[model samples]
Target: MGFKFDWFMKGMLGAVLLAFLWPEPGAKGGFLQPELLNKLGVALVFFLNGLALSLASMKDGALRWRVHLLVQCSTFLLFPLLGVALLWGSAGWMAAPLQIGFFYLCALPSTVSSSVALTIAARGNVAAAVFNATLSSLIGVLLTPLWMAWVLHQSGGNFAVGPVIVDLLLWVVLPLVLGQFSRPLLKDWASRHKGLLQKVDRITILLLVYTSFADTVKEGVWSRYNPLLLLQTVAGCALLFLLVLALTQWGARLLGMPRGDRIASVFCGSKKTLASGVPMAHLIFGANPAIGLILLPIMIYHPLQLLAGGMLAQRWSSAEAAPS
Candidate 1:
């Protein structure tokens, strides 16, 4: 009935349909060329993301600086540190490429659209959500590469940070800036067509996932990972999500933040953007097909974060309305 449940069901149904329709992993010939389809899908996704973003709403100065700081620290700092620790602990057991993927996932930015959506759904500070989400994207362009380079260097892998930054500018930053600039003209139109825009967003994300998964299947990358290891990685992701959610919520409360700001902090701080993460993966790990395999953890985590945050937001809203 609710949008959250409806979307979750759609995602699950889509994933199922994809798995069944394209059962064979490496069979390439399909309805369309995968590369072109992927590029088109990604473009549409970013465009809708741009439309959904309200730069007008971003001017609100209601954010508690302390809460914002804590969100950034958790998203950019603490998460990566935990990833590094995981890599170290799993060094003897896990494959090198998978380890790199783990680290890469940790370095990604906080999600923009979903974070804002969840925050708003939770009756949180939407403007603060936008600010932090935007800041995370800008910060991620630089920080993700640096963190990746550091991890790779330690692991005796060769990575060029300069090229990565250049690619990021071309692929992520430029488009984002263009979207921001174009928002003024499109904002009113987009508001009137919110349902259409949401449809576009969902379709775009589904296509992106389909292509990325197709690529991984075509490369036989999934074969490298055993079912048990895959299960463990998924379990690890769940635990990490819970830990971050708890930590962010606790940190926000400790900072004496209002309910709205606390919700924004928890939603924005705890989640990573698959939309951003997928594009970055295509740029960074494109040469090594195995690298795409690393994004699986993030893909699994993204939808779960949305569903969980949606439920939590509803609960919080009810609690707030109750007479004490």
Candidate 2:
């Protein structure tokens, strides 16, 4: 409960190291270069996501408009703003790659599993957590790209808007909608196999990581980063997370959301998902070696959020009654 190993996270760590050493397995024209395999994996991630969603839960959760709006805005709006502020504050400190990566981190969606788990631990609105977290992933498929594209365009970085939207719709939304449409047929099977299915999602993410890093390592990208820079990146991720966590808590209370919903806002709004991030990055950036660097902040943030959120949940749960 305190610090858990997200298999996908561990896989991503392994992937970077492996890419650094060999770079063949995950590289283009290699056995694991992705190609059609990557598309299938991403599609499967969202398909399973759709299968796991409960329409009734989403409906009920949506009715809490204030809570829902707060969480979504905190995630999509506030997080990006904080990232920009951090970029400004660290102007001389952070490199361009790190800055871009950090900005991407801000644009990511909340983690569905960890957010909901922490919400339950904190005695928050778990149903709302589920609804909002799931909704965030769906929203992220569209929003993250738009933000990234606009930012990159403003900065004169390369961005292909048309292809990005096409890829997202094909790999993310399309599969998701298909799964939702077929949920009535697969609901019982999905429910029973939830544990296994979740593993599948992790494995798919791991595959994406391998391909992403493989692409990067081939370019000798790791040569640029030293231990000091790595440590600073971690520090940057921690600072961004802590600041957003504090802000979400304050905003939730100010919005007059109830205690249960506030916990969900704080937990879900504060998290960024490696599961969704890695694959989406690969999809968006396509094996750019800098992706390993791009994913760096998120890789560090994943565990920090888990550990920090767990500690906060333990404290928050004691203050409120567990939901029915």
Candidate 3:
């Protein structure tokens, strides 16, 4: 089979280019009213997420404590510690906004969709993947903010936690709860239109990316940085993915986990959600043009994980099919 390029990824890159060439529509105070759309997109994504969640599957996956613990720790702890170490080591060398982006990338939750999709392709414990990915996103609402607050403080920037938390609860948590409650009435319909719902999620993310880069470009945020710096940041994002992936694999092996559980842990633990990251950045940074700059690391990291995870899943799938 021929390799297929990810359409959503291509769309994202195009969105960035569009922002560069013609950012007028998406920028703040522009004709599109992207700010209003962004807010709606955030709420819509979470509501769809809540509506799609499977309570029974979640219960079943919850029994695997070891797998869950490893995924959560690698996501929230191992990655963040690595970010801090990198920041400390690169103190004199790297740019500040990019530094914050890198750390924020580290603290993000496991991606809900891609993580589960890759796990299933790899013949992993699907239930556990679903549970862990969902759990990570929920917990990230709280943890990501806390981590960003510290990063902002360290960089001498301000973070009003009270307002940010209120916004998150209002836009993120509240919509999610409503969606989950609506599931009793909407689950069958949601399940039937899964493909459409997934598209909605992807489109919202693309919209967020477009508006953010538009704001950044309009404010001349990229003028201060060079293309070479971006190349380096891409390298940094790739390295971070590799390091966490290796750690998760090693931890799974040391615990003598079954192959299925190990695949679940490795994939789920290594992913950082660009979907959640972008919306949260908007809430946290407001209209600061640097919000786009702060999103660079995860934007770079997302595709890297998808490419690598796809290859790994194919290999694992073939291995599982082989005769002993």
Q: What is the C-alpha local distance difference test score of each model?
A: 0.74, 0.83, 0.89
lDDT of 3 at 117: 92
TM-score of each: 0.85, 0.94, 0.96
Query: Against the correct fold, how does model 2 do in TM-score?
Result: 0.94
Candidate 1 lDDT tens digits, 266-320: 9889989777787677667655656446776787677678778878888887887
Error of 3 at 235 (Å): 0.6
Supply every candidate's count of residue pairs whose N, Cα or C atoms clash at under 3 angstroms.
Answer: 0, 1, 0
Global local distance difference test of model 1: 0.74
**Which residue pairs in candidate 2 have backbone atoms (N, alpha carbon, C) closer than 3 angstroms, thus clashing?**
216-289
Measured with C-alpha atoms, the lDDT of residue 243 in candidate 2 is 89
Looking at candidate 3, the ten consecutive residues that score lowest on lDDT are: 1-10
Worst 10-residue lDDT window for candidate 2 reads: 1-10
For candidate 3, the per-residue lDDT at 269 reads 97
